[model samples]
Target: MKTFLFRSMIGIFFGAFLAVAITNCAVYFGGQELLDGETFLKNSLGSIFCGWFFTVSPLYFELKNLRLSQQTALHFMTVTILYFSLSFWIGWIPLHLKSILFFSGMFLTTYAIIWLSFYFYFKNIAKKLNQDLENI
Candidate 1:
């Protein structure tokens, strides 16, 4: 129970961090377009929610005995790619994919960034926990 709670909290923190990362990236790259407060807020919140959803697969993999790296990566890619397509197609935020292949490429790139960010965030926490356990 405790391990589950701890890992879940770490996952949630990673989700939040991923959100910030996306928001910061947008601000850096799309400053002019996001000048409006409403657009900025929408993008910020959207990134956070999507980050949370993406983080779930990793957390599940951690909880389960998922050993196949290739399978895990493929599964994550499939889910995230579909999420991007659905979000764009539903008029949720107007992704403007332009092309199916192009959208998939962009989705994979974004997923890689978020996944790496979450990986480091969770690793730091796990290291801290392990050190504390060793001390005790």
Candidate 2:
């Protein structure tokens, strides 16, 4: 319970940070402004939720520490495939049966974000787990 709470907290903050970073980059390079705060917030929320790998990896390792079952790995694979497929399809939906770039970029970016997110998430989890175990 405690570890999950900690993970959730970490995930929320990291998600927000990621959202803001991506949004800012988009605006800076794309030179497009949001029509309203609502739009910005919606987009940010989407960005944050998309980075669940941040919380998932640590939760997996945490489960390992607790000597939990291997279902975690199974869930990870399921969630991963689902995330990629959904993101890819939804991202290029507007392309409407045409446009390779749309699908390609969407697929690549989805995977890229997952990879980057997990890198930081797993790194932090490892550090904290060591600290936690040492104190135990």
TM-score of each: 0.45, 0.51
Cα displacement (angstroms), candidate 1, residue 8, comes to: 5.7
lDDT of 1: 0.65
Error of 2 at 31 (Å): 1.3
Per-residue accuracy of model 2 over 9-109 as CA lDDT, tens digit each: 77777878987887788789888775467767766665566565557554554444444346445545755665555455445235455555666577567
**Per-residue alpha-carbon lDDT of model 1 for 1-136, expressed as tens digits?**
6665665566567757776776677678867444667755665556555555554545555545556475467668767675765467444535554565676678679867977886789899999999999999
Worst window of 10 by summed lDDT in candidate 2:
63-72
Which model scores highest in TM-score?
2
Off by over 4 Å in 1: 1-34, 63-74, 85-97, 108-136
